[model samples]
Target: MAVRVSTDTFEAEVKNGGKAVIADFYSDSCVPCKRLSPVLAEIEEEQGDRVKLVKININFDGALAEKYGVMSVPTLIFFKDGEEISRLNGAVKKSEIVSEIDKI
Candidate 1:
């Protein structure tokens, strides 16, 4: 499962530090976000130590959403060494996500 984070811990946990992270910015009412959740979980399970998965609720963390310029839900951002390296927006397939992770 993806680790849920709030704005308070986002900078400490995900920004400019730690291992590679896949940050999912989403809203509770979004259908695409719901659909992508399982796919992210599967990626986390498969990658294990290679990466970390984080789920950020836009409604709960508006500041983070604004910081990332998340105009839409289900925005998947990839971070390496605390810097954003890549991103995937919307309900993407498992292969596509894996491809991005592989690049990192």
Candidate 2:
């Protein structure tokens, strides 16, 4: 399962994590976010050893979203070694997400 993160926990959970981190910036009211949740969970289950999945609710953590330049919901930020390597916006396919994960 993807862990919920707020501005206070963002750095500790994502920036300081050892494995590749997928920071999902989403909103509870977003349909795309709802659709992406299960996909992310599946990915987390399959790649638990290689990745750390964390979710930042944009509605609650607007500051964190602003800091990351997230203009919309369901944005995925991929980090490796505490730095952002890539990102995906909107509803993305599982293959696309997995491909990006494989690269990092």
Question: Which candidate's TM-score is highest?
Answer: 2
**For model 1, what is the C-alpha lDDT against the true structure?**
0.88
lDDT of 2 at 50: 94
> What are the per-residue Cα lDDT tens digits for candidate 1 across 1-104?
67789988887778644568999999999999999998888889999678888889999899998998888989999999888999999999999999999999
lDDT of 2 by residue, 1-104 (tens): 78899988888888664799999999999999999999999999999999999999988999999998999889999999879999999999999999999999
TM-score of each: 0.93, 0.97
For each candidate in the order shown, give its overall lDDT on alpha carbons: 0.88, 0.94
- In model 1, the clashing pairs are 16-82, 17-82
Query: CA shift at 5, candidate 1, in angstroms?
Result: 0.6
Winning model by lDDT? 2
